[model samples]
Target: MRVLVVEDHAFFLLGLVTALTGHGHEVVTAGEPYQAEKLLGERRPDVAVVDIKLPPTHSDEGLRLAALLRSHEVPVLVLSQYAVPEYAISLLGADPRGRGYLLKERVAGVAQFMGALDRVAAGGTVIDTELAAMVTRAAARRAVLSPLSERELEILALVTEGLTDRGIAERLVISVHTVVTHVQSVFRKLDLPKTPADNRRVLAALAYLRNG
Candidate 1:
């Protein structure tokens, strides 16, 4: 895959570039948004892996750039240094197809990072489990997650990470049958609202968790 990586931190950028290239992905990189925009137009990469903070203002420039990429029908997977639900929700809320939000630290997990990139490029949503856990914790604070058992809470957090039953089962070292049963139990307990985007069960769950 051809990837456009936008990051300001020199060290992080170098490591990311190395990782992408090592993973057999063609990589184009920029230290800031302007160069990133230039590369985007010139390279026309298959996907973008953007950092939510950048140089100059060091604020939301990366987010704005990601939005522009999305407008041009480019897939984007945003990386952040912190677990901010608002940032994650904002990025994930706008035409979530081919979009994702994950923590910067997750890059160390090469398998996980590669998986997220592939999924986003294929028009899938990927949220960091840490951020998902934050949403789930907030749900508990609001008594929204109170009905779930301990194991159910664990599964629900993974669900927000956009994991399938099989993926969750593998992660928890359990059977897919058990995973399916637990997933059903989770939704049944929470009774999430009926969402128009049937495939976006994660977003629907997030919306309820964040706003409930």
Candidate 2:
């Protein structure tokens, strides 16, 4: 895959470039949002890995870049040390497919990080499970939507992580029937239709991300 990496940290940026190259990807590096924008105009990459903060402003520059990339139909994977649910929410305002939010510390393993990149490149959202949980909890506390019970919230988080009903049941130590019931309740509360399981999960996740 051809990738554009937008990050301000010099050493980490070089390390990421090396890692992606080692994994048989062509990489272009940018230290700031403007540089990344210039590169985007010149060459289209399969995916863009962007930091949520950048030089000059150190604010939402990366968020704006991600929005621009999405407008051009480019996939984006945002990386950050902080969960910053707000930032994730902004990046996901576009199409859910080809979007990801990964915590930097969790990406120390090359294989796992590359796997996230591959998932985004293939048009799948790959949010960190921990971050997703935090976001969901915050949303529940806010009551922006109907509040979910603890068990229901847990099932929703697992659903966002792409786990199967049986997997969620096993992880939560609940029966498959119970998991199915929780899932149905979650969909109803979130106002997500009883469509395909995957679509329901995506819509539920979008609600959690938006309201959280």
In terms of lDDT, which candidate is strongest? Answer: 1
Q: In candidate 1, residue 22 scores what lDDT?
A: 95
Local accuracy of candidate 2 as per-residue lDDT tens digits, 113-137: 8977887887777777877677666
The lDDT of model 2 is 0.78
Question: Candidate 1 lDDT, tens digit per residue, 117-187?
Answer: 99889887788888899889878888978888999989888888877677788999999999888878877
Worst 10 residues of 2 by lDDT: 195-204
lDDT value, residue 164 of candidate 2: 57
Residue ranges of candidate 1 with Cα displaced over 4 Å: 193-199
Consecutive 10-residue window with the lowest summed lDDT within model 1 = 192-201
Displacement of the residue 1 alpha carbon in candidate 2, Å? 0.5
Specify the highest-TM-score model's number: 1
